[model samples]
Target: MTKPTLYLHIGAGKSGSSSIQAALARCAVPLREQGFLVPGDKLEPDATVSGHQLWFFQGLPKDEPESQKKVLRRLLRCKNAMAEQECHSLVVSAENLINRRKFPDLFLDVDKHFRVVVIAYLRRQDQYIQAHWQQWGFKSHPDFDDWIANGLGDIANWDVALADWEAAAFKKQIIVRTFERPKLHGNDVVLDFFNILGLDGKTFDLGNTEQNRGFSELTLRIAERNRDLFDGPHDNRFFAFLGEHLGSVVYEKEGGSIHLGKEDRQRLLDRFRAGNERLRKTYFPDQETLFDESNLPDRLELSEAEWSQREHDLIWRLLFAMHRRK
Candidate 1:
């Protein structure tokens, strides 16, 4: 009998992964009808709503041998169930998989059973860093420059990060998609992913809406200031609450969010120029550049006076809003 194909979506985070996962979960029935199995539904029913967290745990630290064994057993059970159900394909998605250094060894059993196709989405490094800073870095490193200087920039080295997966013994192929709006199908990541799966995206129920919402620059600043209140950087509930309440606030001040100056942005890009070029040649030979840079703006740095004033006004507004609410 022919081995089933496994479509593994290893997210380079902040790349609309949540939206994709939600859509996949919602359309589990439709996908199974088409012979594609979303393992979460069969192996862990609750995971269909929360995402493929079960699979994600496999990439966690190797200290929990029992937990790892449990996950492996569940995966094997899913594989057996798929065979019984005559499912020819499987889809397992988890953004955290991108961080797994031992991906090849971890998925050796999976590779033995199914033909593995690794799917990943890559965002421009500058945008990625900015998004990540807002999402998690603010809790630990309030200053964006400090975050980058203190080794966060290393995550943007896609070539280095994906090299191990590329060379993985079981990988049949690796699909690398640029997470830019223009590059996506129908200007949507969900549509782009369905296009990759050779399915009609319009037919699937996309659920209520998109999964994650971005934080405004103002909210990020506030969150950074109050990061100590949270348990840790992963204290998503606090961050989400702040964004939900303050994300839409417009300071209407002289300066916008703190962004890397033109020179600094160019330097950051230049730092990874060689590796990006190599990636472009190897995966996207048809394209001249790995990322489209035509629309990037040269944001000016805010003067200290302007920044201080903006912060003062923002705090006053927030305090007044809270007082009124009470």
Candidate 2:
């Protein structure tokens, strides 16, 4: 019997991972009928949010030996079940898996059972850093300079992050997709992913599920100022509430915002230029460039007075909105 193929969507986050996961969860049954198994539907039936997060969690270094064994057993059981059902492919997606430097070690025992294909979406470093900072760094570091200076920029280095997988024993193929809209098939990550799976995306329900929108500039500045108050596990709740209430207000007023200036964007792109070029040549030789740079934002320089006025107005509006909500 031919071994079932296992596709791992190891993410470079700030890409549209959440939406893809949600889509997979939503279409689990239909996909199974088509001989593709989303393991979370079987392994984690009661999970509120889907995707094989438990698989990744159990594979972590901190997990107990017994717990790891349990997950592995469950995975084997899933494979057996898939075989019985004649499912030829299993897709496990988790954005955090990109950070696992020793990625092959996690699947060493199971590589023989499946042809493992690793898939990742690479976003431009400048946009990735800005989105990542807004999503996570603003809570702790607040200042973009401080956050980037702390070596967080290294996360965007796809060549380094994927080196272990490139040379792993489980290497069936590595599919690297550009995260830029123009580059993606159908200008959508979900559609691009379905295309990768050899499925017509229009066949699926493809609900209007948008996930993880970044905070606006005004909200980010306020969150930065109040970073000290967000020093707990529930900080995400606070950020979500602020974003839910105030994210649109700034957008309505300012049209759109650009977090990185032209020079900063250029500097970041330059820092990763060599690695990115190597990646482009290795994975996508047909493409002229790894990422399109034609539409990059021009320089943005805000005067102190302008910043203060924007902040003051945003705060007053926030206060009024809160009162109205009550």
Candidate 3:
């Protein structure tokens, strides 16, 4: 039988992307038996984020297609692996990939020879904007406002970035998820997601958040201090030399209280409401009202001293693990 194929997921970043990626990586063996082919045992490089490898600057000249083509060349190599393996379906799960203006153009290239579908998750805009800001802040961003003015600050209109997925005519080809529901735990979400790809889950590991879940204020500050540190490949070495120091620098306690404020938050929330309405009109109903903010963990609870101890302990443990691996 000719191996049928589908690109099962086109992600919305920070919406449990790490967990989903972790689940697929852990269950590679079982997933293969079911005819799905995920990438091999390696973390794929992210070209778009702070490290600057993807070269997705908004105002780059059209004559400078060379920059984007470099990224596409790498993607083609990955696509070749999927086709050669003759796996049932493939999921291209990078949130930033869909954030580009050329999403439809890019998908057309894939659908020329393969079936393609997009899977995405949504969080309320107000909450997500704040979370997204805090995430960027975790990188030790000194001038946080500048980062917001340029980068994900406009993410409330992220669908606008992708030419709005609905405008791409992916009605039957896309999956949109809201993060409000609790059952969407990393593995459980994928188990439910599998039905869309004609997949089924089996005995597998839990979510990958165990090691990197909590973000203390202290840890977030450390991350922001040397923001541009851990990034990109170094001569085919997947565990680049710089990333080796992530434990030394980052920790669950580094993140302090978020300060996006009530006024700024309200503005962002209003934008999200507009976008959410647009999304529901095109896709599902307005079932997004279910997310209640009262249940979220308090962000300002951790003191500096408490977080510093946690940071030191986690880093010490990580250094020991790395030493043992050597």
Please give the lDDT score for candidate 1: 0.73
Model 3 C-alpha lDDT per residue in residues 1-326, reported as the tens digit of each score: 45346554555555656556666666666665666666432212212222111123333345435535543554455556655765656555565655666645444444544666777776666566556654543344456567565655456464574345556566577777765546364435555555566654544554443322334445445555655563521121212232455543443342224445555555555656665566666666655542444443334555669757866876786677678778
lDDT string, candidate 2, 187-246, tens digits = 999999988999988899979656666656666666767777676523677666666676
Tell me how far the alpha carbon of residue 254 in candidate 3 is from the true structure, in angstroms, after superposition: 10
Which parts of model 1 are misplaced by more than 4 Å? 41-48, 58-72, 170-172, 243-257, 300-326
User: How does each model score on TM-score?
Assistant: 0.84, 0.86, 0.65
The local lDDT score (0 to 100) that residue 245 gets in candidate 2 is 70
Better of 2 and 3 by lDDT: 2
Clashes of 3: 17
Ranking by lDDT: 2, 1, 3
Which of the numbered candidates is closest to the native, going by highest lDDT? Answer: 2
Question: By summed lDDT, which 10 consecutive residues of candidate 2 come out lowest?
Answer: 40-49
